[model samples]
Target: MKVVLAYSGGLDTTVLLTWLQEKYNAEVICYCSNVGQEEELDGLEEKALKHGAVKCYVDDVQDEFAAEYIYPMMQANAIYEGTYLLGTSIARPLIAKRMIDIANAEGAEAICHGATGKGNDQVRFELTAYALKPDIKVIAPWRMPEDFPFEGRMDMVKYLEERGVPTTVSAAKPYSMDRNMLHISFEGGILEDPWNEPDEDMWCMTKPLSQAADEAEYVEISFEKGIPVAVNGEKLGAAALLKKLNALGCEHAVGRIDIVENRFTGMKDRGVYETPGGTILQAAHRALESICMDREVMHLRDSFIPKYAELVYNGFWFAPEREMLQAAIVQSQETVTGDVRVKLYKGGVHVCGRKSPYSLYSPELVSFDEAGGYDQSDATGFIKLNALRLRVLATMKKES
Candidate 1:
């Protein structure tokens, strides 16, 4: 049998590579997707080959990931559970799709993942795998009924050490981390206790508030049809633009959140995330929409924010309903072209100024000094007409 495994060079996956080969007597082909998990990919392919992988593929999909997956989710301003940016949720589908593609190209019969049974990623990976290729076999060791030997990180570490395999994980710091271009998520270990605060040293992207820059920094972002095209007046590709914003946001301590969220499996999990670029993008995008988007249209799109966010969070990125919502959301961004200036200071992203060629804001009409149109007395009739239903209800109560 031939198998394609999603290899991350992490503890679970490193052990999984050897186990799959031993247990199933299969030829394991390792594939790693480079979605901006910087420095983590160093010597990844060599490590996989040194183990039991018959072959290894390290594909750079960062630009495609930013333009295709991350940008579309931003169009909906999707926020899961009203706080999380859905950073980790949004990256799974793309990774899974690429895995399936590799499997087909390599003539593999099965694709495997390191996602555990208790987490949301297992569902995300399998759903996308089945959705793309219904007949494709999936092997999840953690979900197997007592077939996998290792119980936790410590056990996995011991197994690797006994076999003379070097691993990054240790008994002292056993928490897991998942990183992509959008964000980095940290969970497990001490984070399992909702009351425990994450160690300051564990943070990889953003600076702590106290250690952040003393002076506030202002940044201007240009948007074309709701997609960011430039930062500080310089044009860039989707990936470059996001990277630029991430640097700025990090300098000012922009995005970091810790929450106990309800997972799709009906269990609550605690997760900590750092999303520097995405945080700035969300604020700037809303600011541009404020002027360019119509009140009614914006309201209608806003109504779908929660649902759209929920769909993405629950790993329905390829579902018909999500695509349907995306169509409407994308249509609403027709005139969402503008520049928004934001002030970043001590973890706060605040929109300070916004301008758009399609702006509906009429300064003269809103001026306190003068009425843009000669219609001061027209308000009386408009107000009374709107109050007709309330007046009728009051009269009916008085008569009763």
Candidate 2:
């Protein structure tokens, strides 16, 4: 038998690598998708091979992740539950897509993942896998109680050590983290409790607020049709632009969110997220839309924000409804081209200025002093017409 596993070189995946080989007597192929987890990918293939994998494939999908996934989400202003930026939620489908490709190429009968039974990742992975390739079989070892009865991380570490599988992870770590170019997410361990504050040491991407620069920093982000095209006049690719913003925002201690979010599994999960670049992009994109987008069009798109965010959060990237929503979102971005200047200070982003050539805002039409193009007398009739229903309701109340 043959199988392809999504290997992360973490304790759970490393142990699963050896366990699959022993239990199923199967040849295992390890695949790691590089979606901007900078230093974490170091010696990953070597580690996977040493842990009993027949082969290891590390593919770089950072550019595709930024352009294909991140950009479109930004265009739609996707924010789940009015808080989460959907950093980890958005990365799963791309990883699963690549895993399916690897499975097909290797002619493997089943694909495996290290996602625990309780988390949202398992559903995200399987949903994408089945959506792309319906016949593909998914193996989630954590869900099987009898075959894999390990209680926790310590047990998994002990199993790996007993099997002589080398790992650098320590069981004493207080939390689990997932990192990529867009953001760094911290969960599990001490973060499981809602009341406990995240340790300062757990932050990787942004500086602590106390250590940040005292003076505010100004940054001008340029967007072309809702896509971030340049930072401070220097043009860059999607991934490079995000990395640049990440560095700038990190310096000012920007984009740190701690919230207790509702998971798809019907559990509340507390997470600490540092999304430096993503935060800046969200602010800049919205600022640009304020000028570029028409009022009614913006409101209509705003009406779909929650639904769009929910779809992405629930792992429906390839669903027909999501695609339909995405089509409309992209169409809404046709005029979203401009530059927005923002001030970053003490972990907050303030929109200072915004200008767009496609701006629907007319200074002449809105200036009160000049009467502009709007007639004040016309508003009397307009107000009377709008108040007709309210007036009728008031009369009925008086009669009663």
| Candidate No. with top lDDT | 2
> Across residues 32-146, which tens digit of lDDT does each residue of candidate 1 receive?
8888888567788889989979999898989999999999899999998889999888889998998899889989999999888888899999888898999999999988857
TM-score of each: 0.95, 0.97
In terms of TM-score, how similar is model 1 to the real structure? 0.95
lDDT of 1: 0.90
Worst ten in a row by lDDT for model 2: 164-173
Off by over 4 Å in 1: 161-169, 172-174
RMSD of each: 1.7, 1.3
C-alpha lDDT (0 to 100) for residue 18 of candidate 2: 91
lDDT by residue for model 2 (123-234), tens? 9999999999999989999899899989977788788888777677754668878888899999988888888988877789999998887999999999999999999999
